[model samples]
Target: MLRGTAAVSVQRLAPEDLGPAAADCVFEALAARPKPVIGVATGSSPSPLYQALAASPRDFGSATWFALDEYVGLPQGHPESYAEVLRREIIEPLGLDPRTVHLPNPHTGDHQAACARYEQQIAEAGGIDLQILGIGRNGHLAFNEPGGALDSCTRLETLTEDTRSANQRFFDSPEDVPTHCLTQGLGTILAARHLLLIAQGAGKAEALRAALKGPVSRDCPASVLQLHSRVTVLADAEAASLL
Candidate 1:
């Protein structure tokens, strides 16, 4: 476990080794609860971990899943929407019940109401047991971009240009990337009992370093992880290179 100003445990590992190590965290959470509420993330960084969980023989039918964020304007079945992404990458593969999965409603006319309702749902579920996270290149967590208030709750947010550009690959063209998103805020994420952050590639190194080593500030939202008591960061060599 890391000490000093940061209250996290950092593990630097080879890219191929990240999946099993992260799976161990999920297994432990499952062992501790009959119906664990697992917070799920969508991105390339978590793909390997999801694949590892799907390949495991252990039953995951009892777990409840909540997605971290979703694009606001996308249709229900849009392939690039976070909901569809989660369904394709984890839900169907793991054979988890569709009824047990939850995500922020992107199609609602009143997005604020939807965000509030999502928060209520999480609170009713007794909060998340384990939250899997991936830091953005700009140090955002979920869609809580840089400069966002540290205590912000579940809400809608405007994505940064960098965020949109980074996500453009998922869409047919850069213009198709949604500008706004609904996300679980830094405050909401900190409510989870445990947090597991997975990052890879050299592109993530600078942000990872700032998140782990820099002062807690809105300038680098991922740096807020330093305030959490039970954060476990699993970074491949390239991501941890600056650390």
Candidate 2:
């Protein structure tokens, strides 16, 4: 998946190509380290990556995993929830023990406490080795939308109308979409040793271009990746058109 952006190694590939590419990277990372901690994102975009990892021959028995974000008030069993999606697509197929999968609990009455506890859990697991991401149409990463601070940490955030619209597919109706979320902060995400941001389809071309070619700004949260030491961006022709 690595193509044309020089700041970070960019690879352009078709939408379907995401799965095997992710599997290969996960395998390579696992082989290169001991008990690798993998941070996963939830959405339609990363489904292929999870599939590829599941189909791989490598065993993920000892690996630790963390989710990048979760809707603030959604129940764990909600079909539109990221936690449920990750459990079905990534956790189950990869043979990971459910106990090793860490996700921010939105059910807690103290939301800030949940974020702190989740951060601590990751720290105790020795931090994430690799973090997978998907760019929002508005250039957000997780729920770190426009105006997000450069050094923000894990916390609750309000979802923008654009983000809520984009995520409507997960819910029965646009109104069913949660207006807020608990997401890993820009700083928290950047702490990962490596980042793999994947995008595909003509719809993402503009955001991909902005994230790669545009100046860093809170207006485009993903643009902060430019400061990271290691980042791999994968896009399809439509998404790579700007590059």
Q: Top model by lDDT, which number?
A: 1
After superposing candidate 1 on the true structure, give the runs of residues whose Cα lies further than 4 Å from its correct spot: 1-6
Evaluated with TM-score, which candidate comes out highest? 1
State candidate 2's TM-score.
0.96
Each prediction's number of clashing residue pairs: 0, 5
- Give the Å error, residue 150, model 1: 0.6
The global C-alpha lDDT for each of the candidates, from Candidate 1 onward, is 0.92, 0.85
lDDT score, candidate 2, position 153: 85
- Residue pairs with colliding backbones in model 1 are none
Candidate 1 similarity to native, TM-score: 0.97
Pairs that collide, model 2:
1-11, 2-10, 2-11, 3-10, 3-11
State TM-scores per candidate.
Answer: 0.97, 0.96
